[model samples]
Structure formats: C-alpha cells, structure tokens
Target chain A: MSTIARAPEPAKASLVNDPKVRGLVYQAVLVVVVVGLVWAAATNAVENLRAAKIASGFAFLNSTSGFDIGQTLIPYSATSTYGRAFLVGLLNTLLVAAIGVVLATLLGFVLGVARLSSNWIVARVATVYVEVVRNLPLLLQLLFWYIAVLRSLPEPRASVNPGLGVFLNNRGLFVPKPIVEGHAWIVFAAVVIGIVASIAYATAASRKQTRTGEQSPVLLVALGLVIGVPALLWIVLAVVAGNPIDFDMPIKGTFNLRGGLQIFPELVALTLGLVIYTAAFIAEIVRAGILAVSKGQTEAAHALGLRSGPTLRLVVIPQAMRVIIPPLTSQYLNLTKNSSLAVVIGYPDLVQVFMGTVLNQTGQAIECVAITMAVYLTVSIATASLMNAYNSRMALIER
Target chain B: MSKRIASLALAMGLGLVGAGLGATTASAQATLANVKQKGFLQCGANTGLAGFGVPDAQGNWSGFDVDYCRAIAAAIFGDPTKVRFTPLAAKDRFTALQSGEVDVLIRNTTVTMSRDTTLGLDFPAVNYYDGQGFMVRKKLGVASAKELNGASICTQQGTTTELNLADYFRGNNLKYEVVAFATSDETFKAYDTGRCDAFTTDASGLYSERLRASAPDDHIVLPEIISKEPLGPGVRQGDPQWADLVRWTHNALLIAEEFGVTKANVDQMVKSDNPEIKRLLGAEGSYGESIGLTKDWAVRMVKGVGNYGEIFERNIGEGSRLKIKRGLNALWNKGGIQFAAPIR
Candidate 1:
C-alpha cells in the first residue's frame, strides 16, 4: 500500500524537450533581479547623499585626529594623523587576537584531552566546563567577568598578593615584568637556526619513511637539532663575545607595583573570557574529530603488533586530522572576529579605538567606517587564504 | 578535521561578509525626512545619570538632558511625548547616532570641531559647559588637583576623560596610570574599590556620580578643570531647515534664561516693552514664518520648559543632590558662556 501511494510520477518532459527556453527564462530572471536591485539602491543612495551634502572620499583619514587615544600602542597625541591612529587600532586588534589565540589553544587542548581521561572526576569536570561555558553568550561572559569578578576585588594598595609579589586587585593583575636588553640577538638567532634545522630533519625523515618503510630517527634527531644547537650557540656566542644579560625586575613603589608591565583589568578580563569561551567550542570539535576515527581501526592497529602510543602517532591521528583541521580553522577565525567584543571591556581594540572613538571625535563617519570595514574584510580574507593552504596540505592523496 | 573544517570555514567566510554588509547598510545613507516622519524620535541619551538623564521611581525619565529631548520633540510636534530614548554606553553612543538608529543625539555629547565635520553630525548650540576634574576621598588629604599628580586615575574608557587625564598630567610633568573601564559604573567601582587614587570626569558628572556613592561626603571634587567640554545636542547633517529648528530651539531656551523668564511667566512676558522679548515672543514679527514655524514657537518652548537655567536649577542645581553651581554655564551677562545668537 505504501509503495503504491509513493509510486514515481511521470517525468516532466516539457523542460527536457525545451531546455534552451528553460535556461533562458532562468537567466533572464537572475539578470533582472541583479540589475533591478542595484539600480534601486544606487538611486536611493545618490538622492540621500545629495540631500545631506556629505562628501564621500578618503581625505578625512589623513586629517588630524585632534583627539587622543588613552592607551595607544605607539606614540600619538592630538596632532597625529588619522592614518596613524587607524594603525594604532589595527595593532591593538592584532595584539588581542594573538594573545587570545595562544591562550585558547592551550586551554582547549588541555581540556579536550582531559575530557577523554580515565579519571572520572577530571573528565566530569572537563565535561561540565565545556557544557556550561559553550552554551553561554561570549559577550555576556565578558561583561560578567569584567563587572562581577574583576570589580569585586579589593583596592589597589590593599592588593591581594598571591605569591612571589604578584599582586591582584580591582585595579588589575600585576606581575613582574622582564626588561629585555639589546644583547639578546645572538641567542634569538641561534633559536631560529635550530627551528629551521629541525624542520629540515623532519622532512627528510618523513620522506625516508615513505620510501623505505624503515622509520628514521626523526623525533630524536629533530629534538636534538632544536635544543642542542640553540644551547651550543648560546654558549659559544655568550662566552666568546663576553655578552652580558641584565636582570631588571619590578620595584615596589609607594603607590603601585611599578616598573613591571601591568595587565589592566580590562585586558585580563577580555583575554580570560575569550579563552574560556573559545576553548569550550574547540573541545566539542576536538571530540567529534577524534571520534570520527573508527574503533575497528584502533583494533586493527593492535592486531598488527602496535602499542597504543605508536598506533595513535602512526595510524589514528593522521586519519583523524582530516576531520579536525576544517572545524579548527573555523574556530580560529571566529575567535579572531569575536575579539572585537574587547570594546565592552574597554580593551582599546581596533573597532573600539578607531572606528568608535575616533569616528565620534572627527565626524568623518564615511571614511572612518569604510577604513574599519576594509581592515576587517582584509584580515578575514587573508586568514581564509592561509586556512585553505593548511586544509589542502592535510588532504588525503587519492589514486 | 581538515575537510569539514574547510567547509565550515567557507560558511563562516560568508557569514562575516553578511555581517559587514549589515553594519554598513543600517546608517549608510539615512535621510533627514525619514527620522521626522517616523514619529518616534530616536534620541540618544544616558540610561541613569542622576540629574542628567535618570529614571524616576515611577520609571519615567527626568533630568536636564531628558528635558532637552522633550524640547526637540515639542518643536517637531506640538506634543512633547513623541520621544523614544536610547540609553547608550560611551563607546556605542555615537555609533548608534551615526547608524541612523537615533534621530538626534541629546546625550551629554561635547561639541568639537572634529565631531562637527568628521562625525557626520551638527551641533546647533551648547546646552552646558563641562570640564574634566578629579574626585578623591576627602580623607586622602588631596585638596587641590595638583596633589593628584602621582595618583592613579579611574576613568571610563572610550571617552575624552582619559585623554584629558593624560593632558593634565603631562602638561604638569606628573605621572599616572589610568585604570579604565568601558562604562561609567565600572569606573566608579574601580575608584570605590580602591583600584585608583582618584576618579575623574566632567565636573558635572562627578557631582552626580558622587551622590550615588556608598558615602557621598567621603569624596571631594577638586577645583581645577582640565578640558573644555561644551556639552550640546546633535542632529545628523543635511537638512538645514531641521538643523535650524534644533539650533534655535536650544537658543530659545538660552534666550529665555537670559530674559529672566520662567515657564509660568512666559505668557505674561509675551506682553512686555522690550522689543527683543516682544519680537522673540512673536507679537509683531515673522521670525517663525521664514524658518517654517509659527510665530508662537518660541513661546511654546519657553512656556513648556522655561529655559536652560530653569532646567539646570530644577534638575541639578544648588537645590538638588548634586549641589552644582552655575559656573561656566551661566549666561554671558552673568559672566559665563551661555550666550545665544540674538532672538531678533
């Protein structure tokens, strides 16, 4: 009875016989929609702009800000050009993104692995963390951290000293700042050289494994290249050149814990919020990707005389990565974009400093807004291009 | 991870493009007529600044800034009840106005040359004279602004207060670190929490903020003012007629303040000997006709709200909790800058 009711209907033979007419009709509708919408919007904008007499151009970006940013990353004042001001905003945005990315990755990987652990309490805690944080709104979390947690701290001078002179207060988290001197160049150069040598060794090892089925000592040799070369270089450069490294620690002051870098409450709150919120989403993605690798595959690896560690490194992870990379990149991009919420915590990020504050002061809404949108667009586009390259690199090579 | 991530990334890329387009679309080309015809005037204002724009026990808004919104509405329609107030944070205030989300911004917005041109808005007349100052705990023994040189400052982020603090400090060769929060409430908390040595803002705002503190008399406002902030009402650019109406409505209040006119006496003063007052009151002049208004327009405004002085005194003056004096906000004849263009 179901089969009779759901029997196939006769094929629509009209479109097949007149494919040319059908194609032309669809194309005509598409063209009409595109042209009509464009024309209507263009006409409306022209009339509005004319009525308002607002000049549309990029000249305003070169005008003097005539206002000052509170915490500019670079030297700035009322006399600085709007162009430089915009650069300051971009730098702040990049700073937030970079910090948030590092923190979110570390937090995410830890909790992701913990969620899969043998200890019941640890796994449950990780599960609860992922569930609670991921379900809440990021903006609300930022506000909660800023208003409730940070605002509840004691006064500055009565700052809660946790340990090792690290002070926490409503003012902000104050830690000892390291002042890097001019002579740290040779050591840095040695470290970069070691990284390059390790990459070279790893590539050769992978190629040798693919060809001879005989695994090269890539991990040990690469580790040696990374650590041993840097240590040897530091010893040679420092002893031969008699270079000295200075130790400049923060000094206790009458008022503040001065001389060290102070991470204000706004920044601390925003980064902390971004990390917790982003890590939750990342955990889900990590779990799904790990699960995508079948249990049969793991059992097969065991039957082939492989231990759990070797099985993971050689067989499981490589296949699991095909499921992981795409969602992971999406998470990275989302984190980058959501960093704009720094405005809520007053983190002096790109949108808050330049587009919001500067635009208010200068009244050059057209140029200022355009520049801001263009910057975000360019950033996302570049990030997508990089993600694409990474995605392609990890793709399976099919016959 | 890689394949599904690539697809999700593509979908995310589309979402970002949509968001950018959506933001640009809102206020990209808002016209002057659309705001007025909409009936509900979108006025950007503070949520709850006592004596400026705060909600009463009944949840009705009343204060100096709130009154100005009523004045603009009164001028637009004979009724002053057509306003829809949008409470905005310092950072989002101008954006709301710029996006055409608000018709005219009557917040405690400062009138600056940069804003007049670059912000795509027009300031018709200044409604108040504000200057940045510091408020510290009285027990701190900081009587004068000079004592605040080495002190940490708590100020709302994304505002002129931060820059003013820096200017005052650097000009005096003083050193300070600013503890900034995104909202005024947060800044106050930071100060009350003892994160900063002093709380700074326009003197008028300090008066109001201090009134709400845990112990009101515990803090004292310093004498030195750091920056000139001519707080004014703003409207989007491109309608000279509308701009003229808002400008003159503000001036009518100023002129009324100058003429010693109260809301109750505005009708009685309409029959005065002063040509300026008579002409302003619309007895023998057509000032309103040329500006697309009735001659009795000024009379309605003065009769409704009296003048800037009346609004100031009734809301935030000596009789109020703020106990603010008419310093720079006084009329020019009274040795202040509250002068308007001639009513004639």
Candidate 2:
C-alpha cells in the first residue's frame, strides 16, 4: 500500500506451474519406486532361496550332467558337464536356422516372381500356396509333417530305395558316407589351390575389361580354372595315389540301418516345416517389395531399348532390393526364432536340451531360464547388427 | 534437454524399483488361513494321463492322482467336491506350485533329491511306486529291455525316462537310437505308427498307453524295471502347517486301511473299541488340531474317498483298464514299500 519505489514485481515460482520442474519431480518419484522394486525382488529371491536350503549360483554349470543327448553336434557324453550340453544345443539350433534361412530365401524369391508371372496358372498356383501355408499355424504344420508324413514311411526292412545308395525308412534317410583314406588331403589341397587361382584370374580379367574395353570370356576362364584344375588333380591323385575315396553304404540289419550317414527324421521334419512356413511370409514380402517399385521405372528401361532380363537385373532389382532388404532381415530373424519350435519334433535344439531336459534335471529353474534367454538374445542381437550393416549400404544415397 | 530426459529416466527407474521391492517383501505363513478363506483348495493335476489324471467327456475329472487331490479335499472340508482342479503340463507343474497358483500338486510327479531340495517342494508320501520299462510290439520278438539294443526307442523328452534309457544302454555297452517327442501321447503315437521299435516309460504308463494302441493285445511291456520312480503329491515349502495337514491326510488313509476301515464301514469303525482305529478316526487324541484340522478329519476323508487300498483298486488296479498289479505299491505290511509314519 505504501507507494515506495515501484519496482516490477517478480513472478512467483510454483513447482506445479513450471512444466520442467514438474516432469523432473514425477520422474524422480518413478525412478525411486522402480529401483526399490528391483532391489526388493532380488533380496526376496535370495532370502527365499536361502530359506529353502536350495543352492544358488552358477556352480552347476561344471557339474556332471549324467545324461545322454540323442543328437549332438559337439562331442558330448553322459560324463560331460551341463556346459557341454548347452554348446551342443546351441550348435544344433544355429545349424538348422542357417539352413532354413538359405532354403527359405531361395524358395521365397522364386515363388514371389511366380506370383507376378505372365502365365495366369503360375500366378494362381503361387497365390494358393502362399495363402494356404501362411494361414496354417506353424505348430500344427510341424506336427503333421512329423507324425503324418515321416512316420508313415515304410519300416526298415521295407525301406524305399530310390537308387544311388540312398535309403529311406521310418528311422531316417541314410546316404552313402564318403570315407576318404590316405592321400585325400592332397586332393583337398588341390581344390583349395584351384579356388584361389580362379579368384585371381577373375580379378585380372575384370581389370582388363574395365581398362581396355576388351571383353574377355572371364566366366569361362574362371570356370576352367576352378573345375578343370580340380578335375585334373583328382585324376592324378586317383591314378598315382591309389583311388582312396571309399563309399560306405548302409546295410539293412534286422531292426535298423547300419554303417552310413543317417539324417534323422526329426531334422528333416523340422527343417521342412520351418522352410515352408517362413517362405510363404518371405514370398509375400518379396512380392510387395517388387511391386513397390513404380511401373514408370520398368517403362523407362523398356524405352531405352533394354531387354527384359537386362532391365530386371540392371534397373528394377537394385531398386527393389532397397525396399526388400530391411524386411528380409526381419524375416531371417523370425525364422531363427521359429527354429525353437524344433523341441516339438524332438530335434534337440537349444530349448529342448537346455530348457527342457537340463532344467528339469537340475531343477535350477532361474539359472537355466536365464542362460537360455541370454543365448537367444545374443543370437538375435548379432543377427540384427549384421543385417543393419547390410541395410545401411543398400539405403538410398541423397546428394 | 537430453540431460533432463536422462535424469527423468533415472528417477523413473528408481520409482519402479520401489514398487517391485514392495511386492516381493510380502512374505507370510498363511496358506492354511488362505485356503480356509478361499473355501476351496486349489489342486494341480496332470493335463491328461489315462489311469492317473484324465477328464471325462463331460469334463468330470477322475484318476489316481485326481482321487488323491479329492482325498485332501475330503480331509479339509468333509466334502470331496470342495476342490478346484488345475490341469498342468509336465513342464509347468512345478511352476504352478511355486507361484501359489495351486495349493497342492498331485500330478504323478516323482520325488527326487534335486526336485525336493532345489525346487522348494515337499513330497511327504509316495503314493505310487513306479518303475521305468519298455513296451514293444509282440512281433518285435523282444522279451526283455536288454534285447532292445540297436532299437530306435520312442520316449518323451524332458523326463527322467530319457535319462534312464541312455544310462541303461551305455551301461550295457549297447548302441541305440532315441526318437523323443515333447509329449507322452506323441511318443506313444510314434511307436504305434511303427516309427520306433520300442516305447519306453513308466510301467504303469506303458500299460495305460498300450490300451490306446490300435491293437491293445499286440503290445507287451518288457519285464525289466530300470529305475525307481516314487511318484507323490508335491506341496510348496515354507508352509509347515499346510505340509503337516497333507502328510497326516495321506497317513490317515494308510492307517485306515491298516485298521481295515472301508468307506462303507467308516461310520461304524469310528465307534470301534480299538484305540488305534479310534486315534486314526480322530476320536482319541488332538492330532487333527495340531495340523489345524477338525477332529473328524480322518473320518471325513475315509468316509468320502475310502482307504489307500480302495483308492488304488478303484483307479489303477484290477478294477480299472490299466490293470497294474500293486506289487511295489502295496502297504509295507502287505510285502511292499508304502510306509506311512504315525500321525502322533
């Protein structure tokens, strides 16, 4: 009320009125609550474990598993530790995932192109396949393959032999195993040398073509360098070093097949289910990617008097790949994750061995589950990083 | 701006930790009180095992393990219907118990050292004494498991059965192939389809599975019993009061059988002059009170579900299709191994 020097009144600062301050306070409360929760959970787990007299920690990793796995990529025994079982399971998972990805990609590309084929029947057939396979649940498809298809095969005594020393029975498919004896390393060395020489010849040929504008039949020369050299070395090794490649054919015993490399039916059924199921999705992705490229691009290429094959290879494909790559990476990841379904068919994948068998045996639920999750996470993260590197290279370059 | 967001995120994380910690600190010993308040005991059972725990077409559950759960219900409420059944898979059975989703798990689970110690479960009674055996087609000419060398055997994965099979083969220096499936049904199906030379599991399971085959008379379970499988009901640890109740309930059934008390005659036997029978029927002492149960708990259980012998005969004995002989499962006094401790 006393009108002294009237300086402009400073605005009163309220914590709720200031948005920044309010956000900070809310966040601070959240952090405190979350941290307290995590710490409490950890403490509770520890306390409960101690009270139950259950041993905690990862010391069980080195303990003798005292169990046998049906199929192991690494050399493992009942005497091996649980750690070895994990490695075996991991390798088996990677093997199937890698093979499934390769096969799915090849089949997907072919089916995708067929969906857009000029022939009406081809396009309709591809559409039917994609619709039917994609609509079915992968688990049911896997069960059907394992039970209805593979299990329905004839008995060991009545095995179907389609020639070439390959035998198919309910047990498995057995093929002639090539046992390389003495001096086989020389032939392998020669094959390696041939590959190196071919790469060198290819580089030189490409350089000559680029500089002098003189087209060399580099493909033919490289083929000769690769195949011709290998064949000549094989002939020398066979004649001079005594044809050491011996084939071990499977003999039909009373109850089973013996003495050959047998591909278990579980492996076959699992791979077929994964490849067929994932290819349907990948085919749709590929088709969409190709269609995403405008019709104007194709017309422009045709107007340039370029033929269909060259036009597709030089113009359309490069552009479509830019669209296809990111989705394709995701598809590969999906296939890898889906490989865990191998447990259903008893393929001895990581989940089956580590989570199913070892977990049950050890009764170390928390530890086993943590290890299994860590493995899958690492595999996925590694795959994503590799795909990202490839995707960035294919990304559109803006000036 | 980025610094502000970072600090905000950090604060949010701490708040979440507080919430989570608050949930985990709730430790209590009130399972008995909880069950009484809930009015119905939660019982975990097998999803479907023919002679053990199977649901009928009308969804009425009945089997060996199911009867055991009903027995517990009878002891608690004097009514066998006062129970809620949760059918759990082999892999999820322990988790269901540990998470307090079920009060007791009587799902034909085996009692092993690792399971008892590591999973925080207590198995107070061995209701079924089972052993691993192999089943083969009569035409396979395999009379014993030893003759199963080089045979592709169909077995369920994630079971002690698989480990035992491997052990038997390796010990005998024999080579064999295993065609494992995720479920017991799948293994049986694979064996039925002739994909395997033999099917292996518990002898009791083999008999049950054999009945489901296209030709039941064509399969014969081998005579060799490979491993000891003491199957029983599992309860969560840290609940001594609840565990005692379950233990005494099982013993009451056994003791009732020892005293020759059947469900049809339990009412008369409760008035018997024999002190042992009176004690078991909960008339002579305060045994039931110690376990937080009524004095008539044994009478209620016996009158509702009968003695252990009756339960066995009704479910898996000659009265049922499984037709398993109670050789090892017979009471210790009857030349077998089921020995229940004294309730006192």
Candidate 3:
C-alpha cells in the first residue's frame, strides 16, 4: 500500500551476512575504544603530574644519584648517574636469576629422576619434597626461610662455621674468593676452546653413529677433551708463575670477617627460597617431560638388551625433552621476574635498586617503570628464544 | 529463537560494559572531593613498631605516630576517633599518599631529600628528632660506636641506614660487612641471634626495640650518633590548604607544650588572656578559616591528645617502658626543633 511513495532502503547491517565489513567496523570501534581509554588515562596522568609539578621525562636518568648502593658489580657511587644505578639493579637481578636457575635445574633433575627410582624410599622422599614445596605459597616460603631460618642464626662472633672456610652467621655466608691472576685468562680461553672442540667432536660422532651402527664413546671423549685441557693449562700456569691462582678465604677478625667475599643472610635465604620454589616447578616440568616419553619405548630398549641408564641417556630423554623445554622456559622466566621479591629482603636487586631508589630519587615513575618492564620482558624473550632453539633441535626427526 | 537470544545477550553485555566504564570514571574523579564530604580523616600509619604505631591486644592503635593521626583527626573532624588508620610499609607509604589512599603519612617516616622532592610529599614539621645509633650486646663491652671496628653490622635495606653504615665505617676506616634485611624488625632479630656483631638504626628506635627484647637490658644503644634522622609526618604536595592543615596540627602539640597547655589544663588555658593563647584557642577568628578549619582546632588537638612531649612521655619516654629521655624531642623553647608557627 505504501509502494506509491517507496524509497530504496539503506543497507541494514547483520553480523553474519557480511562478516568482513562487520569485522572491519567492529575492529574500528575496538580501536577507537582502546585509543579513547588510553587517552583518558594519559590525560588523568598528565593532570596529576601537572598538579604535583612533577617533570615527566627521561632527563632525570642523567642526573647524579645523591644516594649510594652497596655491592655494585659495576662502579657506582652517590655521584653515579641514575642510568648507572639502573644498570647495577639489572646486573643484580641477572645475578640472582642466573644462580637460581642453575641450582634449581640441578635440584629439579635429581628429584624428578629420583621420584621414578626403583628404590621405594627414594621415590617416596622425592615425591614428598615435590608436593610440599610446590603447594606452599612462594611468598610465605620466602618469608619463612628468610625470617624463620636465616635471621634466626647467631651473630658473626658466635657464628657457626661449617668448614671449607665458610662462615655461617645470621649476617650470611662468607667463603673463599678465588683471585685469578694475569695468566688466568689463558686458562679461561683454553676452557672455552676445549668446550667448543668437545661439542664439535660429539656432534660428528653422534651423526656418524646415527648414520651407521658403529658406536663412539662420545660422553667419555667429550668429558676428557673439555675437562682435560683446562686442568692441564691450570697446572702449567701454576708451575710457571709460582702462584697462578690464590684463594682469599674469609677469616674472622675482632668485629667482622675480613678479606673474603661475604654473601648476606638475606641473599642466601633469597637464593634458597628461589631454588626451592623454582625447583618444585622445574620438577613438575621434568616429570611431565619424562612421562611424555612412551613407557613402551623404554620397555622396548630394555627388551633389546639395553640397560636403564643407556636407554634413558639415548632414547627416553630425547623424547621427553620435547615435552619439557617449553614449560621449562616459562619457569625460568618466572624465576627471573620473581627475583624482584629480593627487594623485600633488601638484596639490592634490579627492581629494588632501580625502581626503589632511582624512582625515589628522580620521581620519574612512567619512564622508570617502563624501562624496568622492558628489560625484564627482553630478558624473558631472549631466554625463551634460546630454549626454543634447543627444543627445536632436540625435537624428533620425522620420516 | 537461539539466534535472537544470542544477539540480545551480546547487546546486553555491551550495554553493561559501557555502564561499568562510566561508573568507574565518575568515581575515580570524585575521590578527593568524596574524602572531604565523608567528614572522617584518613591517616596512614606503620603497622607495628614499638613507639611509632602498634595495635594493642584490643586492636586499638596507640603510639606516638598514632597520636599524630589522632591530632589530624581532631583538627579536621573535631573528633580524634574519626580517623581510619591505614597501615603502610616504607616502600608503599609515598605511593599510598600520591594515589590518594591516605590523607597523611604519620608513620614515623624519616624526612629525606629524595622523599621530599621525588615523592612529591611535603614534610610540614618534624615530630621526633632521631639519629642513627648502634645497639650491641652489653657483654661486648662496647660503650660507644667508635669502639666497634670491623663489626658485622645488621642494617635494614631500602633505608638511609644502609648508606650511613657505609659512611660511618668508611669515615672511621673501620671495615664492616653489612647484612641487610627488608624490615627493621628482621635486622634487629638478626642482631638478637648474634648473627651480626652490632645492630644499627635510629637511636629512639633502638630504645623502643630494646624494650621488646627477650631481656630488655641484654643490649645497649651505644652513645655514637652516626647521622641525623628527623622523623616527621608528611602529606601530599600541591594542596597547600591540606599541607597547612597537617602542619599546623603537628606544630600545635609543640606550641601547646611551650605554652604549658596540658590535657589537664587545656580547658582552663583556652580562656587565657595571653594574645598567643587567645589566638590559638579560637577566642580569636579568621586565622584557621584560611586553612578551612575552625580556630579551636589547636585546642581540640591539645585536649584530644596531650602535647607532643606528653605523647612522647606516654609512648616512649620516661613514663613508658622505653624510658627514652627527652634529649632531642624537647620543645624548641627548651632546645629542640619542634617549633610551631604562630596562630597570627
């Protein structure tokens, strides 16, 4: 009836009928919404910044820090620039993360393998450790270790020495620091060359064995090549230079331990907490990786006259690694990021030094927070890339 | 039917999200204004430290720092009980103030240059004069800080004490390895276990900590004052009115002490003929209205909590278990820096 005055209809939109156009519109709307939210946040930040008259920029990084930090790996002082302070914090974070990763991995592998042991007692003990450590809240564990264990130790004068020139006081562990003399670089270079040579030879030997049925004693050969050269060089250097390396062991003085490197109780506890906490997670990963390997494969190797050690070294581990590595990277990243908790223990870590002191000094929150986040993200990404490459290499060779 | 229901649900979800965002923006913007309208003053304080801020068995906050919180509450709301104590740590204290989490920081915080400038906080007045001092086992036969060389000092990190330990040791050429903890309590505990040869912190703090010891007299605070630590109450900068209100409230305790206005006599002193007294007690007007407060705010503070000296005596000084002397916390008129600006 209304056709007498009919006008051509404008297109009515439906989400499904034209998903391309619809998706474009929806995406455009999302972009606008995101941009608007960002704009609002930035505006609010600017207003607050202006109200407080706080300068919002990175210029403060060049400003001299009027405060000082203890135990800086690089040169630092009250006159050090904010940038220098940031580097110190980053270095400390790397230090804790590096040490924690190594110790945790070692502990994890041992526990994971032990949990699968034929010895009932060993398996039960490993299982108990894994369950207890993994289930506990990391922060509570850290506090319990720091306050309940380390801080409860006796003072330095009444310190408990556990041999090896190591002092165990509430202050921390003081141990011998090896001072490497000039010719030490030669030993270090030799070790590096030895390692590369060993790896190259192992790869060739493994490839040859994989192609042919002939066997190569690769593990023994590699160990001999890698360790042998370094030991020989050290001996030669020692004989030629009279004293190639000297040990500066901590000796108790009237009021303090003098001459050796001292690791504070806070640091020791933090490392312990980090290792125990990370090891639990790493153990889970290791377990998963091992289990991912088919049980039938291990049985087959044993049926074919192979022992558990040889089967594990050659077959089961290679398969298990594929399952283990991705998760392993995540755990490693977590350990690195969680190292920020060192601030609570006054470990002078990256987060504590850079974000805590530098932020307090410069009052440049936006820049400082951004830089710290970027560093952590970069480190995590780099670590992940490395592990991923290893994982890819260790992956199965499919027909 | 299913398709129709899906569209309706999506539309409703979008609508709800839009409403939520609108509500959040409005609430965040009006936070500062809402605080004033609410009438109660919010004060941030330390969770537990002997003389600064500690919750008793009944959970009532009672300490020198808590008293200052009450003073601000009294000044603003005319009721000291109107305050809400938000416990904060050394690291989170400034952020809490900046984020409008609290109106004032009365946490026995040391006034430092970095805190003053970078934190965008204004330290209106110092309530306590403190200095870094060492505490050692009395059996060590250490009488003064200078007597201890090569001491394994337990120092709290993220504090000025760490830096001062280095300075003191370096200045005296006394080599020491510093064992650091995140909290003062932990640092002291380390020393208590004989893990450190000495424990170092503020002199006033050491006195309070000594009282909490398993045996109070087992440790003695050495006489050597390493560095000045002027502990004070601070508030956010930029709000001059707010800053002045907090400052005047802090300074009143000192002013009241100087004028002999005790809790016992404040009611009588309110009607005194002295021009300073008249002006301070609200017998005169227009002075406090400038800071958006009543003229009787000073009288309310003095009456609510005794003067700064009275607070000190009750919490940490000779009247308390700490038995700390009024060596540096005395009124400016009697040789301290607790000076109050005149009401005029």
Model 3 alpha-carbon miss at residue A116, Å: 2.8
Best by TM-score: 2
- Candidate 3: CAPRI quality band: acceptable
For model 1 the local lDDT of residue A6 reads 75
Model 3 chain A lDDT-worst window of ten: A37-46
**Model 2 C-alpha lDDT per residue in residues B1-344, reported as the tens digit of each score:** 46645555454445444433432433435677888889988999877789898889988889888888888888888888888899886666776777678899998788888888887778977889898998988987878888776888888866778888888998998788877667777778888988889998888888888889999999988999999988888887888888888888888888988889999999999899999888888788988888898888899998888999999899889988888888988889899887888766
TM-score of candidate 1 to 2 decimals: 0.81
lDDT of each: 0.74, 0.83, 0.77
If ranked by TM-score, best first, what sequence of candidates would result? Answer: 2, 3, 1
Taking all chains together, each candidate's TM-score versus the true structure is 0.81, 0.91, 0.86
The residue-by-residue lDDT of candidate 1 on A1-399, one tens digit each, is 655677679777887578898899987896576555545554554444444444455676787765455456788766788788788779878877788878887788678767877799999999999999999999999988877766588765677887765777765677766544555676677677778888888888889888998888877877777777766766776687654344344455545566555677777778888888999988887677767899999899999999987987788778877887788878878888898998766677788777666665554454565567667766876777887898788889898
- Candidate 1 per-residue lDDT, tens place, B19-93, comes to 334434444343335656787567788867889998778768888998888877765565667778888877677
TM-score of chain B of 1: 0.90
What DockQ would candidate 1 receive versus the native complex? 0.27
Q: Which stretches of candidate 2 lie over 4 Å from their true place?
A: A1-40, A204-223, B1-28
Write one digit per residue (lDDT tens) for candidate 2, span A1-399.
786889988897887899999999998897677666656755666676566554567888899887777777778988899999899899989999999999999999999988988899999999999999999999999989988666578888899999988999988899999998888777677777878888888788879988997877877877777778767777887898777677899987768888888888888888899999999988998899889999999999999998988987888878888889888888889889999998777788999888887877776666676677667766876787788888889888999
lDDT of 3 by residue, A1-399 (tens): 866987879688775778898889897897577556556655656556656655676888888765566567888766678888889888988988999999999999888888888999999998999999989988888878877665467765787888888887766678889999878888788878888988898889879988997788888877877788788888988898866778899997777677678776667777899999999888878888898888999999999999999999888888888888889989999999898988766677888877776665466665676678668866886888789889889887899
